[model samples]
Target: MNEQIHEKLKEIKQSFRLMMNGVASHSMREKWVAYKINWGVPIPDLQKMAAEYGKDYELAIELWKEEIRECQVLATLIMPAEKMDEDLVEVWMERLRTQEMAEMLAFNLLQHLDFAPALAYKWIASDRDMYQLCGYQLLARLFARGMEPNERGINEFLDQAHTTLEGNNLPLKHAAYNCVLSFCELGDEFDVIAQKALADLNIL
Candidate 1:
């Protein structure tokens, strides 16, 4: 890393360390068992810090390489969506260790990517749990932003969600439910389809 990036990272880490809460960190670990490190800085505080620091693609990437959970969250917040691409998205997705991280990544960064819709489809089809979670969450975020997929894309997503709901995987089931909810938010046409799919899968 360059000197500027290294200095920025040090500053960010210092801020996180100063704000760390041991009790909150322990609670977070219990809630997200997959995450091994937690600085326990709150989301609002992280957002404020990110806004203050502004977007820094190189610094974000370096922060993401750290083991601490808060660092990863900071990375997502500070990352410039304009700098994001398929390769970097894939790398970050693979690095995600928990559903919370995946959700944060989707909301803060992935949803802004030009390739998000295509990636959502591909990741939703994956067998991996984290990828599936991120995919569905991204789909929901996209819908909220009024980005509509084509008819065929909608059908494929509903079909996949139906199949996923039939399985016993709780995490994936939650993701599928959220995906259906996003579709429902589209209007009566999509609401009917979402309702039927939920009923058919006994997820209602």
Candidate 2:
């Protein structure tokens, strides 16, 4: 299994070299996106690669262990969400280093977990900005899928969001704003609550 995975990883790395975009890679570096190696493959191309390779748990795990930006994004795309557990999720989250990775993980994998709501709630309360960003992005994904929070959940999410919006992290603010928009999409009930929250923030 290890040998096969290594072989597969070698092939993937070769593919990355073939598809690499120097301009895009430079852009990511200019934006301060740090990774040990960034092949500069765009997400759409990675998506195509993922579809071609299909989901492979071992392969995804191996890809994620690499510090390459494209590898991590591909890991998120090809990993089986159902196979993810809280501990594995935490381990993966700890390795996150950029907003790009956070968004990719949230959109492609995190939101599909059985305990996605729990992950969102737990991460939103963290002092780490990346965790908060991932939390909000995951929340946005869930909400976009028509998930609604209970009264308690609403209060918790709004409380964290209120604090997050008032902070200095522009990326987190954008994520939280999108999350609120998604929650508001649930219906008139959620919309009213979100409006009230926005008004309290003097954002209305």
Best by lDDT: 2
Q: How close is candidate 2 to the true structure, as a TM-score?
A: 0.96
Task: Give each model's clash number.
Answer: 0, 0
Candidate 1 per-residue C-alpha lDDT over 148-203 given as tens digits, one digit per residue, 9 for 90 to 100: 77888988898889888888888888878887887788888878877776675665
Deviation from native of the Cα of residue 102 in model 2, angstroms = 0.4
* Model 1: lowest-lDDT 10 consecutive positions: 195-204
Model 2 lDDT tens row, 35-141: 99988888899999999989899999999999998889999999998898888898898899999899999999998899999989988999988999999999999
CA lDDT of each candidate?
0.85, 0.91
The most accurate candidate by TM-score is 2
lDDT, model 2, position 14: 89
Candidate 2 local lDDT, residue 29? 90
Task: Give the CA lDDT, 0 to 100, for residue 27 in model 1.
Answer: 87
